[model samples]
Target: MTNTAPSLVLPEISSARLTGLLEFLQSAEQLKDTLRSGTTANGRPESTAEHSWRLALMVVLFEPELKDIDLLKLLKLALVHDLGEAISGDVPAPLQTPGDNRQERERRDFLTLCEPLPADIAEELLSLWDEYAAAVTAEARIAKAFDKLETMLQHVLMPRQEASFYAFNLGYGVDRTDCSPLTRQIRDKVDGLTRALMEDAGRESA
Candidate 1:
């Protein structure tokens, strides 16, 4: 009788590969210390890790309004969107200068960080990061919208005195045309909130 037993397929992961992955993870931990321009509810500056975590949650919270999207892909995009910032550090949009090589620098840093992983894993990560950076794909566009939305929300939530920088930030280019319906709605809401805050600040100063 011919043997009908299925052959066992062991995973190809090696100890050295795992060690490399671990090193990459350890390096990623630095993101927690990378401060962003936005502040927390308590007025402390926020970190890239905090921003990414909140952005991931925002994906789930806004999923209902973003129909037909691949939620898992969006989630992954949110998590890895700023992983490059782990090495490049957080640079506020308003502070970025024209002809700046920040994107190229971040891309190189991202590649270096991914180098420690297996080829397949590294390729997947690089692909995701590139997609998010390109912002051409539907998922990428939505992710970019959420990133701006989160920043706007943070600005609105922060104390008025501490958030004066937002006046300039609000005027910064935020194109809603490419965003999902839900993202557009949120953008409108953020606009309204920003206007109200500005008005309040004006009244208080007067």
Candidate 2:
């Protein structure tokens, strides 16, 4: 009783948690190096961080087009949308379909990474991630849609390479119109734009 509950030792707890978060976030950044077999405009492999960062800009572009959307929330969601990839790696759309892989798996991995975070922050971010995957709200839907658009945009920007065309032409399409109106509008524009890009790439290669 001489030292007032032995100083409570909370600092160590907090410091350890912080150290873990920093470690995980740094690891998250390296995920950008785990390429998706998708090339950039210059035909270079894309890192996970680069993919997420570019998608953020695409989300920014949709702010004006969204119907009663939360721009700031969407931006944050886009920023962390793929943070789980640090653990799961970049599991692109073709392989990550409805059943084989889902949000639950990603959420589990994200939760593990944030275990050091104050429970509230960890839970909240996880919830935001779930919301992003669900595409239930306007902000989340648009953020999620921008995620898809970014993949296509990468195809548009990619150099004349087989991977570039594969990204643009192979196994990519949108089914639901209601999930995102702005995204639907953008998709229409992307179809022709990506096609032309592919043609240009083909010409250059030829």
Candidate 3:
């Protein structure tokens, strides 16, 4: 028999990993998506990674318009908004998916992962996450509005597409009649982006 040392079983997410955890942010951060499918816009459906990237871009582009609000903080707030998805994954919209209870489940999972994290960072992320979900504060409201608007943008970006991004029609994919004025403004800004995609992509382009 050969003499050998047994492998040590490690606990969840060691300190080294915790220090480097931000790298995990780039992985597939979206849910309510498919493995090999295009978006309602003909562009590939956004993974959670793309979603955050787009949101960051939006915040930068729109910050000048938001003269009254503290946009830098809002951008930081929006940036980490979906990291919880690393644990729970994303669900497209609340209505279409059933019984996942994603927010609660993901929160629990993240809380566990927070153990190895520095206290302040973990608390800040959790607070930002809750703020996004609440949509109560001005920054949170603005962030949430863009979040919804971006999802809708995918719908109108494709004309010939059958439109199955979600179960509901939402009646005029670009409509934001019920959303707040800030959200509507964000829609106005991104509206041209979708149009540009349609014009450029024609039928298909990644």
Highest TM-score: give the candidate number.
Answer: 1
TM-scores of the models, in the order given = 0.88, 0.76, 0.64
Flag the better candidate by lDDT, 2 or 3.
2
**What is the C-alpha lDDT profile of model 2 across 72-133, one tens digit per residue?**
88888988777776777777665656676557676777777677666676777887888887
Deviation (Å) of 105 in candidate 3:
1.3
Please report how far candidate 2 places residue 64 from its true position, in Å.
Answer: 3.1
Task: Give the TM-score (vs. native) of candidate 2.
Answer: 0.76
- Worst 10-residue stretch by lDDT in candidate 2? 162-171
Which tens-of-lDDT digit does each residue in 1-206 have in candidate 3? 98698978986876676664653343323322322122544455556656666777878887777767778768876777776666666665534356667778867765665555566767877888787777677787777766667666655554544323222334333333235666666566665555554455544533
* TM-score quality measure for candidate 3: 0.64
Query: Rank by TM-score, descending?
Result: 1, 2, 3
| Model 2 Cα shift for residue 7 (angstroms) | 31
Candidate 3, clashing residue pairs? 29-48, 30-48, 31-90
What lDDT would candidate 3 get against the real structure?
A: 0.60
